[model samples]
Target: MSIAKRPNPLFRNLNAKIAALPMIATTLVVFLGCSIWTVIYSFSKSRALPVNEFVGFAQYERLFRTSRWLISLENIVIYGVLSLLISFVIGFILAALIDQKIRFEDTFRTIYLYPFALSFIVTGIVWQWILNPSLGIQETVRSWGFENFTFDLIANRGTVLYALLIAGIWQGTGFVMVLMLAGIRGVDREIWNAARIDGIPVWKTYLFVIVPMMRGVMVTTLVIVAAGIVKLYDLVVAMTQGGPGIASEVPAKYVYDFMFARANVGQALAASTVMLTTVLIILIPWVYLEYGKKKAQR
Candidate 1:
């Protein structure tokens, strides 16, 4: 008879654990710790400098009551929904078109993705010029036989967010296209063969089969695009500057202005907390459902 020994769990994968220490420490200290601190300070009446005095929900109430903040919230909803819809629609369309193995595939891909290389600020400035009435699309069209052509969308308050969307879609659609292309290409070749054998229409196969299989990629792309929408500040700054009277204001800008410009740390933190809550609300339920489905499949 021989004695058997059990392995110690703590010592298992010791090298990997050591390698991950820095990242774990950083996440705990920077993200978790700072989040707790912000939440704690948010309940206090902190101004330019933080104070210990507790003030309950005054900050939140004040934040909600402000007209500018309300307007910013409305802008975010409109921009967020439209941006998500358009990006996915145009991106998937472009990806599906290019996936046909057509001639000049590389050229078309490069043309589509080229705009993604430009920074948002640069893209905003370029679009600002293109949308300018005096020198851009409007002017060019007017210079032709018709002098009545007007293509200005950036100047009007009602249509200004749409102008921002036009620039955003131009800059971001390429990225979404690349992601969708990768996901579509990653679908198992056998699935396509099976669909073909079953005589399933191409559109139905894509709509019912491929889209379901690409949920992982879609989730990743959704998170990235959603983050961009939530932090929509630089583009608005470069193009509109919340102009036409705060028409393009976003939550991030509201937090910044409160923290820096107004020197109301508590109010800013309250705003920041609400922003975090908003992101969680948008993501948590979908993620939970995905997890449930995966567990059930397993």
Candidate 2:
């Protein structure tokens, strides 16, 4: 009698799966595993290092009550909202304007996008010098017989965040512009022809038809920019160092300070968990609507 053959259990792309095993293992062990550990330790009373003393929400209570943490929360909210709105608008506008077949298109695109090649630290330092009251914009303007010019927002408590906002936009909007331009280019030429045939104005076409069709690109951009806003630390450190008396503090900086400077690992982990939860809350619905439904449909 002939023996029955054993069937292969793995997927057809066995080689590809094997190749990805290292990365898969890394993701599970490093990212997911560390995240779970951090969340667990956030409830502890650890100091100097992670421990298991079990604090029972006491760390979180102190976190919320702390003035620095509260200020950081408020600053991040303001920064996130304003940065998203301004960057989206400016980027889309730049992309659209460049799409008009303007002269030296490549040159203009290079200039617009070059800033994105620089790191946030570099951008922050450069802008810090440019915005410095004694040696930068204000000084130059004053020398130009405009001594009454008082453009010292970076040094002022009430307006330091906006100064950070300006530097952020200058550095990031270029990348957004490039993304928006790609999305705009991906639009069907047939749609534009039809819009023109119907005597629709170019502005109206973009505002009504083009933008709505680029929903995927817009959502992707929003997610990326929002993530950067949430994890804002380097730029603030390089530029303001959360200065002007904690006016420009942000959550990521707070976590860093607590973890390293103060040696309060438990409190740092707690604050980090809060930040992670905030991000998940914003992302989960979007991910479900965007990708989950498609998987279900498939």
What is candidate 1's lDDT per residue for 1-298, written digit by digit as tens?
1223655777678899899999999899988998888888989999998899989998889989998899889999999999999999999989988988899999999999999998889998999999997899999998896888877888888889999999999989999999999999999999999999999998899889999999989988988899778988889888888878987788888899989998989889998998888888878977898899899999
In model 2, which runs have C-alpha deviations exceeding 4 angstroms? 1-18
Q: Which candidate ranks first by lDDT, i.e. highest?
A: 2
> Model 2, range 1-298, lDDT digits (tens) per residue?
2223543556556799999999999999988998999999999989899886897899999999999999999999999999999999999999999999899999999998998898889989999999999999999999999879999989998999999999999989998999999999999999999999999999999999999999999998988889878999999999999999899999999999999999999889999999999899878878888888699899
Instruction: Please report, in order, the local distance difference test score of every candidate based on alpha carbons.
Output: 0.90, 0.93
* Cα RMSD for candidates in order: 3.6, 2.2
lDDT of 1: 0.90
Error of 2 at 50 (Å): 1.4
